[model samples]
Target: MPRATDAPPTATPADAGPAGGDHLGHGLRTRHLTMMGLGSAIGAGLFLGSGVGIATAGPAVLVSYAIAGVLVVLVMRMLAEMASALPASGSFSVYAERALGRWAGFTLGWVYWFTLIMVLGAEITGVARIVTGWLPGVPQWGVALVVVAVFAAANLAGVRKFGELEFWFALVKVAAIVVFLVLGVLLVLGLLPGTDPVGTTNLLGQGGFAPEGVGGVAAGLLVVVFAFGGIEIVTIAAAEARDPQRAVGRATRTILWRILLFYVGSVAIIVLVLPWDAPVLQEGPFVAVLDVAGLPGAARLMEAVVVIALLSAFNANVYATSRMVYSLAGRGDGPAVLRRVSRRDVPWVAVLVSVAFGVVAVGLNWALPDTLLGILLNAVGAALLVVWVLVAVAQLRLRPRLEAEARARGEELPLRMWGYPWLTWATLAALAGLVVLMLADGTARGQLLATAGLVAVVVGIYGVTALVRRRRAAA
Candidate 1:
């Protein structure tokens, strides 16, 4: 028997919508989604955090990207199926509600919400620190507050404005990477006008590509997965797209592969240009590479680009967190006040709530500056893992039912995962492997444990909520 949370095969409010029958305006188009996805995944992680991985694993970091990239592809394939078919405001959480039940939905929704709200501060903190490089006199907390205010307004104005802003933000990031890739090939081939070919000396010289060995590659894989965090935002934004079904399908299809290109390609270029043992690996890999190339003013240019990228993520997360809160509120899982929308059909209360929570994160960063912030960041790290697990599970449960419906209707699904049950199972196994890797890696162990403890509390809250609902129903 189907649970109440699982809607029938026929399209529900999310799929059969005047923008999912929610108050949000449906102004986003295919272009916005494509660019948004492109931009979201290419932020501070690539610009700054890649250094940590490259320095740790040396040239073997490429292998880490390949490993994590495969998992992201599988997860997105599963996501495209559910999102294209269902198309909800809350996305994975809504899918979970239908496939796994209300408890699952509530759990995923709030967990993700908490993660975004917390990451919001971190993104702002990244922006603050990055900008400080350019203007050393500014206080980090002040910059954080200013950016939070600026992007918060951008989010509240309207979904369309947010989409447009993301489109440009993503375009700048894409252009920068494409230029880097071109210059990279030129350098390798010794075709950069006056420069001699650096060739593959770095790749071979660095202790035969796996200098840190397989164990180092495993550790790097954990960091690489974290880099892939923001790619899922396109699906989350799918509910607001003009053609939710087609928009999500196209975005999902195009976005993930491009991410692999940028990430893998960029990492390849960096390693080729600079040896893994290079001291520059301690900072932004892009900056380190450009500085090695001796391009005039490269350092300042790289710093500016990175600051823009971090702020872009800050804007995207602001939009995502608010929408998630609104989605939950609309479904009666969150406080009713968060469900309130404005004349523009924007969730005003939800935006305020998210920004308010972000303020708390900012304060924590300012106050503790060390211990508590680490715990907060690590807690959010496990969020993407839980989300991907639920997304795959939801698709696995929903697939057979969806196929049966499509056959009855004499039509094919707009998007389908190849190898169905088998592929789905394989993806789950792969995710399990990543989790085990997290357990094995000493550096990642704390994050895994912290995230697990956070999940326990959320699950416990759901248990109590379910018990109360049952008791009230019995009366």
Candidate 2:
């Protein structure tokens, strides 16, 4: 009943290959893929940070979001093109190795992994903020600890359960955004109870919409970049999808529209419905908008939604962080223990290690008080954008070889990145500029330092490992 070719390949310690163990189970489906994409894209950024961006850029923040949205779409397209070509558990890390070199893979994988763990810290801190608002008596440290334990346990349950949980978590977020958007649209059209038709005057009325001028827009771009950090998780999750290529392709194609509608659409409505100078934006934009509508139970509703949003982020980060570790282990870049999979087809060691690190972040949030979690948040954004640049470069390097291979095999590539070499280069250049900008600004310098320090550490480890291997070989 079995063919020799059907047997799974065995892995060895010296081989940078995925270990044999129930195959990590391709348990994700199209629905899971879709919701995961939505879940990754929608986060606390929209609810919390949009107000900051709007304040910085005035009405031009809409333009800033649009610009950032395009960049994310392009990056996702580049990642999808690569993922479709060789769908693997290692995701962009594998793409970098195959396209560039072992160094590229080692560096980018750790950087991405670092970003995820740092976000794990930030997510717990964020949840604590919302929680403290509800129960003023509770300490931030205790709340963060409770949130981490709950979400990490959710992640250890296995991919299917994680996907199912995120599906509902994503649904709650999507529903909130949709309801907000509908209310915004209705309010603008003078359709809501006791509300008049708001004209476009709000767009230009608040000090001509560019009160802070071009400099403000540039400053606002930092936060705009952060808003897009989580969008790349879809690529990581795609490797586990039933039809990885199709899922990635479908998700990429539709993701642009979703970002436009949920992010751009919602912000546009907020600017139109309320004055740009509203004090509520200082507190919280999403909360402010609902309170403005004078809806009964709006504050409680928003607090609940924000809590769900934070939990969803924690869940996703743990999943992303563990998968990153599992991938690094599979490729010989991390601890061998991380490569071990459990009966549930989950990477148990990797998950626990990631959770342990998350717990540390929680502890830091409580004890340190004057920590770099806030700075690392910005650094994580820069690092993620840097990862995007690496993915784009990797694709540029590998596309020709991939095309040649397909042509030799008499098969055409079904999905190809549009405008190939030049567009890819432009994306890289744009990311480089962002990094340089971050370096030049006093506020953004911390992000550059964190990202550079992390990169250096990974590179050092890689070099040290290589030296050890060379000495052993000579021995």
lDDT of each prediction vs. the true structure?
A: 0.81, 0.78
Candidate 1 regions off by >4 Å? 1-22, 368-375, 408-410
lDDT of 2 at 60: 82
lDDT of 1 by residue, 1-475 (tens): 1111222343223322222334677789999999988898898788878888888788999999999898889998888887777676788888888788888888998889888877887777777766766688877777778887888898888889999999999999999999988888887777866778887789979698999899889888888887888878887788788887788888878888899999999999999988888888876788887766768888788878887888888888888888887777667677666766676667777888888877876787578544544565665757889999999999999998877877787877779988999999999998999889988877677777877787888889989977986899799
Looking at model 1, which ten-residue stretch has the lowest summed lDDT? Answer: 1-10
User: What are the per-residue Cα lDDT tens digits for candidate 2 across 11-42?
Assistant: 34322223456246677877777777787778
Residue 24, candidate 1: alpha-carbon lDDT: 75
TM-score, prediction 1: 0.92
Under the 3 Å rule for N, CA and C atoms, how many clashes does model 1 have? 0
lDDT, model 1, position 364: 70
What residue pairs are clashing in model 2?
A: none
